[model samples]
Target: MAKITAAEVNKLRKSTGAGMMDCKNALVEADGDFDKAVEILRKKGQKVAAKRADRESSEGAVIAKVNDSNAKGVIVSLNCETDFVAKNEKFVELANDIAELALNCNSKEELLDAELNGLKVSEKLIEQTGVIGEKIEIGDFRTLEAPFVGSYIHAGNKIATLVGLSAQVEGAETAAKDVAMQAAAMNPVALDEAGVDQETIDKEIEIAKDQLRAEGKPEEMLENIAKGKLKRFFKDNTLVNQDFIKDSKQSVAQYVKSVNKDLTIVGFERVALS
Candidate 1:
């Protein structure tokens, strides 16, 4: 058997981010050939990741990445069964690596199929499942691309949001980030009141009237009561109608208008616990 040296083990550790013992084992198993050792470790890790495929992954992390120039960004939710595994360094690194992969991917399906450090994402997930001993899965993957985009991850990995701005301003990044934060907190259904469909509004109005009637409100006051309730519905569901998180004195739309009239929110996305 070829002798494996400390230098070779350190090199493998640096190259693969595997533990010292894992690197040493691979080196010894590969007869001290560096490249062969890496391959062996990768294959072994993959097998390990695959063994835990069916374990439920209910807890994990949401990771986001932006280009160095801040032109594009992506967010992804990588889930695992236990909070302990979710907080593991390996899992967090995997989540970040996947989010970076998402920046180049146009769709979730494409992202899932894309290669991560030479392995397909699904393969990596399976490998991670084996290592983490949980059924880890990629819950959500979203990317935002524009002249400029910003992202925010709320407390823990419970929520993630991304926002794209049309025109750049002095504090545009912060503003866009605040918008994403609002989306995370408010859980808005539409960008603005106009974006809410008539059918949905009508249904909500009907539900409101039914509840009010159940309470024995006077028939003549039904229209006024329903209108009032509809306004509340808009406040709850519309992005523009939501109170700005930084300052609740104004709605998000009003806050944006105060920032720049030309700044239109081209698009936004939010992912949270289902």
Candidate 2:
């Protein structure tokens, strides 16, 4: 067997981002061939990734990034097998890098296929699983674009929100942030009642009617009671109707109006990692 020198191992480590011992072992396995050593490391990563394929990766970080003009933003969750790995500095940095890539991607698949250094993002994720000795993958990816956009990443990187405004104005940025924070707190189902899907509306109304019938309410009044409950649902579950987190006295719509009468929340996405 050929001996692997320190220079060769260092070169492999630099190229593959693997630990010193792993690089040296790969070099020895590959007989000091750099390309073969890289391939060996990748295969190792693949093996480790496959071994943990069934593992739950619910613990990770949520990251948000906006474009230079703030007209576009993305919120992403990078998940790992354990909370200890989730809080790892390198793990957090990897998630941020993927979020940065999302700013340029049109879809989650594009972001996964995008390259980081010389490896595809998906491959890097597998590589990371090998390094961290756990399962790691992209859990969620969401994006928004409008005239103006702002993103907020909450403490511990557990929740991230992105909000878009109708038009850019003096207070639009602040308003956008406020709306984003509201999103993080309220977890609204839609931007407004109009944006709520018909299926969801139907389901809510059906559930309300069922409850009313169970309560032995008169049949003739069931429709009216369901309609009223639906209205209350919109008020509680939609962004525009929900009370603002900063000042509960006003609805989010009114709070937005106070920022700038012309400003409105055009779109939003909330991502959570648990």
Candidate 3:
């Protein structure tokens, strides 16, 4: 067996972006060979990750990253079995790192396969399971690259929202962010009343009619009353129909129209714990 020195471990750590202890262990296992140590750590991390695959990961952090130009962004949910492990500094760091990669990569599969400090991301997560002492998994990875994109993460680190806007305004980024925050808070299901599915509307109308009948309302007026209630339901659940959080006097659609006639919300994503 070859001796592994502190300098060799430090060199490997610098090369791999791995923890000090991990680098040292890899160096020992590789008999002081730098290239061989890298391979050893990569394989070990994967094996460790697999061993903890069945562990439940209910708690974790949701992280989002936007480019300096605000043209591209990524959101990711990294999960762990315990809230205690989810709150760990290392776990948060890993989440952020994966989010950054998600922004650069096109798909979740690509992001998972991407290299992280030399080892594949999935392998790194597995490797982390050994150190973190919990089952860690990448829950969700979503990337949005649009003309205008913004994101918001609620205070608890559990909820995250991303919004994409299409507009011809100079400071659209700020507006988009505000909209994203609204989505995070209010959780609108669709961009407008028209965007809500007809089936859902029909179901809601049926429910309203049932409630009205239970209250002994006149059967003749039930359909009319249900229709009226459906309008309010659309107002509550649609992004454009809902009142703007900043100003209750006007709906979000009206607010957007006031700012720019051409401004339109393309899409949005909201993520929270199950």
Evaluated with TM-score, which candidate comes out highest? 2
Q: State the local distance difference test value for candidate 2.
A: 0.90
TM-scores for candidates 1 onward, in order: 0.82, 0.93, 0.85
- Enumerate clash totals for all models, in the order shown: 8, 0, 1
Per-residue alpha-carbon lDDT of model 2 for 158-242, expressed as tens digits?
9999999999899988899989999998999999999999999999989999999999999999999999999999999999999
lDDT of 3: 0.81
lDDT of each: 0.80, 0.90, 0.81
Supply candidate 2's per-residue lDDT for 76.
87
Clashing pairs in 3: 49-126
Clashing pairs in 2: none
Deviation of model 3 at 245, angstroms: 1.8
What is the lDDT, from 0 to 100, of the residue 255 in candidate 2?
Answer: 92
Off by over 4 Å in 2: 1-11
Order of candidates by TM-score, top first? 2, 3, 1
lDDT of 1 by residue, 42-147 (tens): 6776676566656666688987777876678888899877888777887788888888888888888898899987778876776555344467788877777776
Q: Is candidate 1 or candidate 2 better by lDDT?
A: 2
